[model samples]
Target chain A: MADMRTPLSRARGLGSAKKGTEHFWMQRVTALANIPLMMFLVGALVVHAGSDYTTMTGFLGNPFIGVVMLLLIFSACYHMRLGLQVVIEDYIHGEATKLLALIANQFFTLTIAVACALAVAKLVIG
Target chain B: MSEQSKPARPLSPHIQIYRWTLTMMLSILHRATGVALYAGTALLAWWLLAAASGPDAYALVQEVSSAWYGRLVLFGYTWGLFHHMMGGIRHFIWDTGRGFDLKHVEIIARITAFLPPVMTLGVWLAAYIYPGAL
Candidate 1:
C-alpha cells in the first residue's frame, strides 16, 4: 500500500482513547467479584428453595443479604453487558444492526440493574 | 485501479476445518454458558420482583418454579453456574501467567467439564437433605 500520511501525521500516534482497557479490566474485576457474590446468591436460593413467601422475603429482607443482593445485581448486570457486547460484535455484521444491538445491550442491562436494585431496596427498607 | 494491484488471496480456515480439541470445546462452552447465565438473570429478576410485589406474586413464582419444567430449568441453571465458574477459574489461572501448556490446559479443561456436574449434584443433594434451612 502507498503511504498517504504526512510526516507530522505519522509522528502523532493514533490517539489513545484512554479508556481502551476499561471494558476488559472491568469484566475481570466483576467476574472476580461475582465469584463470592453469586455463590452467596446461589447458597441463599438453595437454602430457601422451597420456603414460603414469608421465609423468602424474611431471608432476602435482612440488611446484609439485601446489600449483597444489590451488589450481585449491579455486578452481574455490568458483567453481562460487557460479555454480550463481545458476542454482538463478533456475530452481528450489519453496521446499523450492530449499533442498534449495542445500544439495546446497554439499555437492557441498565434496566435490569435498576429493577433488581429497586426491588431489593423496597424489600429491605420496608 | 488500486484494487487491481492487489492479489486475490484465499480466506483463512474457519473452526469447522480444524480438528476440535477439548480446549476449543471448553472455550466455546465458556461463552455459551456465559450467555445462558445472562438469560438466567431474568429468573433472578422475576424472583426479586415477586418477592417485592407481595405474597400473591411470590406464590405464583413459587408455583411455576415448583413444576417439573421449572426444576429442569433450575437444574440447568445450577449446572451452568458451576460450569461458568469453573471456566472463569481456568481463565484466572491463565491470566496469572501459567497453565498454558497443552497437557495442563487439557487437564484443566477435563476437570472443568466433569466438576460442574458433580458440584451441581452435590448442591442439589445438600438442598434436599436440608430443605429451606436459611
Candidate 2:
C-alpha cells in the first residue's frame, strides 16, 4: 500500500470546508464575554423589576446602562447566531433547507441587532 | 478499481452497535439545551423592545411574565442558561484536546448534566427562602 502519511499531510493545508477554527474560537470568545455581561444584565433586570415605565425608561436612558445593554444585546445575538448555525448544520439534512435556514438565521439576528441599536440610540441620544 | 475485484475492507465498530453511555447522553443533551437557550433569547428581545416602547407596552410584558405560564417559561429559560453554560465549559475542555479519557469523560458528562439543575434549584430556592436577600 502507498504511504498514508503523504496524502494526510497534503490534506492539512486545504483547511476545513467552513474554515473550522474561526467558529469554534468565536463561540468561546463570545461565551467568555457573556459571563460578566450576563451577570450585569440579570442584576440590572432585578433592580428594575418592580419599577414603573418612567422609572425603567430613565434607568435605561442612562448613558452607561444604555451602552451596556446595547453591547449585551449585540454580543448575545452574535453568539446565538453562531450556536444556531451549528445546530442547523447538524440537523438540517437537505442542502436547500440548510441554506435557507442559514439565510433566515442571519436575517433574523441582524434585524434584532439593528432594532436593538436603534432603541438604545433613541434612549441615550434622544 | 474493477467492480468485482474491489476488496472488502474490514469495518470498524460504530455507534449503532455500542450501548448508549453517559457521555453520549450528555452530548445530545447539550444540543437540546442550546436550542432551549436560542428560544430564550427571543423572550429577552421581546422584553427589551417592550421596555423601549413605553408604559403600555412594558405593562403588557410585565403582566404576561408575572402570569403562571410566563413564570414557567422563565424557569425553563433559567434552567437552559445554566445547563448550556456548564456544557460550554465541557466543550471548551474538549476543544483543548484533553479530558477524553474513559473515566474522566464519563465523570465530566455526568457532572455537567447534574450540576446545572442543582444550581438552578438553589437560585430559585434562595429567591423564595429570602425574597429580600435576592
Candidate 3:
C-alpha cells in the first residue's frame, strides 16, 4: 500500500478539500465560547422575562450584559455559518447551487450578527 | 484497444444496513437541530429589529410573540437551542478523537437527547410557576 503510486495524486492539491480539520477546530472553539455565553444568555432571559420592553432594554443596556451579548452574537453567528456551510455542501449537489446556498448562509448569519449588534447598541448608547 | 468489461463491486456498509445506534441517531439529530437553529436565528433578528425600532414596533412584536403561535415557536426555539448546545458539546468531544468507544458514545448520545428537553421544560415550568419572579 505504501509503495503504490498514482501520478495524478502528486499533482492534485490537498485531498478532500483539506477542510475537515478546520471545521472541526472552529466547531470546538465556538463550543467552548458558548459554554459561558449560553449560560449567561439563558440567565439573562429568565431574569428579564415578563418585563416590558423598557425594562428589557434597560437590562440589556448594562455594560456588562452588553459585552457578554456581543460575545454571544459573534460566536453564535460564526458557529451557525460553519454548521450551515457543511449542511449545504452535503445536500446541495450542483456546484452552482451549492455556492449560492453557501453565500446565502453567510449573508443571513452576517445579517443576524449586525442586527443583534445594533439592537445592543441602541440599548447601551441611546 | 479493447476495453475489458469488469463486474460491478458491491458497496459496503451503508446507512441502510445497520440497526440504528444511539450515536447514529444523535449524529442525524445534530444536523436537524442545526437547521432548526438556523430558522430560530431569523426570529432572533425579528426580535432585535423590533426592540431597536422603539415602543410601537416592539409592541407589535410583543403582540405577535405573546400569542399562542408565538409561544409554540418560542418553545421550539428553546428546545432547538438546548438540543443543539448539547450536540455541540458532543461534537467537541469527538473533535479531540475521543469517546468513539461504544459505551461512552451511547451515553453521550442519550444525555444529549434527554438533557435539552428536560432543561427547556424546567425553564418553562419556572416561567409558569413563578410568573413574576423574573
Candidate 4:
C-alpha cells in the first residue's frame, strides 16, 4: 500500500483543508454570544423557579422573553456542539469510534436544539 | 507481513510525567466543565419540553428538580456553567493577546478557578435569601 513518493512530497499535500479557521472562528463567535445569553437565561430560570404552569408559561410566553430564550437555545446549542466536537476529536482515538461519536454528537446537539426551540416557540405562540 | 514490517515505537512521556500546576488544572477543568455542560443541556431541554407538554409533565419535572438529588445535580451544573463561562472569558482575553506573561497568566488562571464557585455560591445564596428575587 506504500507509495514511493519522497517524504516531502508525501507531506506537502496532506495538511489542512483550509476550512479549519471557519470552525475556529465560529467557536469563538458562539462563545461570545453565550455569555450574555446565558446570564439572561440563568436569571430567568431563577425568577421562574417554583412558578405554576400558567404563571411559568405566561412569563416564558412573553414575546421578548421567548425571543431571548430562543436565541439562548440557538447560541448555546451551537456552542455546545462545537465544544463537544473538540472533545470528541481529542479523546476518541479509534477511527470508527471517533466517527460514530462525532455523528452522535451532532445528532444529540441537534435534538436538544430543536426540542428546546419547539418548546419555546409553542409557549410563546400559544 | 505488515505486523513484521514495522517495529513498535517508543512512546513520548505523557500527562503523568509533569507536575500539575494551577494553570494546567484550570485548562483541564475548563474542558471537563465543558463536557459537564454538554450533558447539562439535556436537562435544560427536558425542562423546556416538559413545560410545553402539559401541567402533569411540567409538574413531574418540577418535582424532580426540587428533590435532594436533583438539587445536587443542579448545583453541580450551576458551578460547571459558571466555571466554563469564566474559562471562556479567560480564553477571550488571551485571544486578545494580553495575558501571556507568566505572572498574569497565573493570575488569570486563578481568577478563572475562583470566580465561578463564588458566583455559583452567590446565586444559590441569593436564591435562598431572597427566594426568587432574581
Q: Higher-TM-score candidate among 3 and 4?
A: 4
Worst lDDT window (10 residues) for model 2 chain B? B125-134
> For model 4, how does the per-residue alpha-carbon lDDT over A2-89 read when each residue is reduced to its tens digit?
7887887756645554454778898999999999999987777777666788888888889999989988888888888989998988
Rank order by DockQ, top first? Answer: 1, 3, 4, 2
lDDT of 3 by residue, B10-90 (tens): 547769999987778887888898898877877777777787778898888788877999989888888888888898888
Write the candidate numbers in order of decreasing lDDT.
Answer: 1, 4, 3, 2
What's model 2's interface RMSD, roughly to a tenth of an angstrom? 3.3
- Measured with C-alpha atoms, the lDDT of residue B105 in candidate 4 is 95
By TM-score, how accurate is candidate 1?
0.89
* A58 Cα displacement, candidate 1 (Å): 0.9
Model 2 RMSD in Å is 6.4
TM-score of chain B of 1: 0.89
Position A70, candidate 2: lDDT: 85
* Candidate 3 per-residue lDDT over residues A1-126, each given as its tens digit: 785769867655676766537877886788789878987877766665677988877787888888998889899899889888889998788889998999999899999999999988887887
TM per candidate: 0.89, 0.79, 0.84, 0.89
Please, what are the lDDT tens digits per residue for candidate 4 over residues B1-134? Answer: 33576457865788889999999888899999998999889998989898888899999998899899998999999999999999999989989989899999988988888899899998877666666443
Q: Can you give the lDDT of residue B128 in candidate 4?
A: 66
lDDT, residue B71, model 3: 84
